[model samples]
Target: MISRIAETGHAVGTAVGYRNLSKKGQRTVKAGLLLSPVLLWLVLYKYLALGYNVYLSFSEMSYTGEFSFVGLANWQQLANDPVFFQSLFNTVVLFATIPVSIAIALGIAILLNQQFPGNNAFRSLFFLPYITMMVAIAVIWQYMFKTDGGVINYFLLQLGVIESNISWFGDSTWALVAIFAIQVWKTVGFYIVILLAGLQTIPEQVYQVAKIDGATRLQRFLYLTLPLLKSTIGVCMLVGIVISFRLFDLILVLTNGGPGNGTEILLTWIYKQAFLHGNFGYAAALSVVMIALAVVVALIGRNLQRSSHL
Candidate 1:
């Protein structure tokens, strides 16, 4: 009887343990069901594709599209390419607009923050360009900057600024300036909206207290508004940097990186390499370089933001 009782107790303990494990298993299965789709998506679309691209960067493909390892040949070619260097230079020039854009946007944001009749309408008007189609904008700007019978040239000629129609897109020296004008025009609205949101987040009571203290407009802006908006400004700066690097459509549609490759940039060059020249491996290498540069810019921006806190 004692042996039989001991055996029964062991059996009960096993049943209890199995019941506990069953409950735990059910919970785990529910969690897996919830997370599996997201995991599958990332693994299939994002992680696997990134890995494949990296592999392609180091390998060359035959006409049959069979990839074979080419070691550092692509990188060596990229390093020696003169057009690559010119593209890099143009990218830097485009990036120079970031601070300028931010400054102008800050001013616009401040103006929009004030109360006025039809304020919302004016705000939308300023922000319209950012949401407009780039292809359409590029085509419009091409006509606006045309060499002969262009509206811009007509105005300049009327003002006695130049003797003849200036080839804005066809001249190497002026091509980038035209690009800068369009870029600033299209992007300023976005920064303004972001900054205006930031401005609205600042407490009205803080500004009221400044006004009560007899602070002048400039002093209040310098001491209160600018200091409080530092984080927002930093974010805008980072966004601007990324946009400058990703500037393909505007360059492609506007100049096609023309005027003797005057406006060539990283993305434009990568597109040309991958699609036009069938240099997939080289283009992949360029893409990696572009990603690295963007990462470096992000790190630098983060460091600056952190240091500002100190």
Candidate 2:
């Protein structure tokens, strides 16, 4: 009996040792595996692209394939460049419309949150514009806003409103207004969808409690909805601000910063500087400034989100 027991114990110990070695060997193999596509993407798409752009910003590389070391030339030119300053001013004007658009989006979100017929249909209708091609939207808007033969002007003309049609892209002041209006139209619906998601995440139980406590609609919105929606709304604002700053395709299709450059934005100006004028170094510097602005905007948005939560 003692001999049989000793033989069984030895067999069990051997099995345990084999199992331990197998696990370690498997782990070692896992650790030394070849690069996955995700790792390759991180190296090629992210790091390499970022490093190259940063390097290009400091060097003068014109279309002629010539390179020269120009330190601070582009950034220095950015300060004195009249059009760059104009573009910056245009960017500020563009951002001014964000609050108004967000306000409209909030109202839409609130309406969509209620239990009503065709609510999904209404939501889809609002969201459709966001997914539509920007080029198509820009073309259609420009036609609608045309100084003559435009549906908008035609309605006003039929009503005997004024002797002259408004030249939306003709004058500097009106040009910016036209761009701002288009931007708001394109962006508000997207933001509405975002706010709608945030609104729906809110608990029905909370609203029921608010009602039992004799809280008004406005009170609930102020005390509960708005406070709880800080994060979602902050993200939407960041997206809107970034889109406004980086607005390119729409500008390219619509006005092209034309009518004497009245509608020029920073990105449009950068395009002109880089491709049209072939000032690569200056354009790179402008690109750096834009990146810096983007960073600042992101930081400010995050800080505001934190403060709102507090």
Candidate 3:
């Protein structure tokens, strides 16, 4: 009887071990199946494309139909390039444009979040700019910023603010400011939608309670609304910073980095280096720098969120 009992115990252990192993294998298979598509896309696009770009960044490839390996030489040349510095300054100069847009968006979002009549209509109207073609916006904005007879200047003159039309898009000095104005106008609505969503997630009861306690609108906004919207604000700011750094199409359409590389940001600078100057490798290095800056901006935004909580 003792021998039979021992044999039964051994059989149970073996079966349990086999079952566990089978379950482990099944889980492994499932995980692989789930990740296969993502891995495939990574291999096909991100990994391979990134690898090629890195390789190209180390060489000299110009539109003049010449290609040569130059090691870190391109990076070295780019380091000493004046236009590169100008581009960096231009990129930084344009950074404020997006934040202003976000602020405007926040204001608009607050208005839309109110239980006023036609709230939906207001929200939709604000979002229209986001869907508008970048090229069209750029074109129309350029005409409005024209040196003479521009609508903005026309109104300013009529209002007696200025005796003459200011060269909005003409002078190199004021050109960046003009670009900022246009960028803000085109994107404020987009930010408003984002802020509106964030505002909606906040509970109505919180505001109601504040109101019940005699909190003024300004006080509630400062103490409760701003704190509650921290994460959303961070996300919007981070995205805005990243997008601002990468602004190319609109800049290209409006100023083409005009008046002498005054408005040329990183991407246009990259285009000039890679295509016009035939220095793909240097361009790649610049691209990496821009990417690193974006990552830094994201990190800063997260840090701000943490501090706001504290």
TM-scores vs. true structure, each candidate: 0.83, 0.80, 0.83
TM-score of 3: 0.83
Candidate that scores best on lDDT: 1
Per-residue lDDT for 100-121 in model 1, tens only? 8889999989999999998999
Q: Candidate 2, clashing residue pairs?
A: none
lDDT of 3 by residue, 211-252 (tens): 999999999999998888888778787878755743687888
Error of 1 at 180 (Å): 1.3
Residue 6, model 1, lDDT: 100
| Candidate 2 whole-model C-alpha lDDT, 0 to 1 | 0.80
State in Å the error of residue 282, model 1. Answer: 0.5
Candidate 2: list runs displaced more than 4 Å: 1-44, 156-163, 304-310
Whole-model lDDT values for every prediction: 0.86, 0.80, 0.80
lDDT of 2 by residue, 189-281 (tens): 889988988888888899899999999999999999899888887787788776675358887787888767877887888889889988877
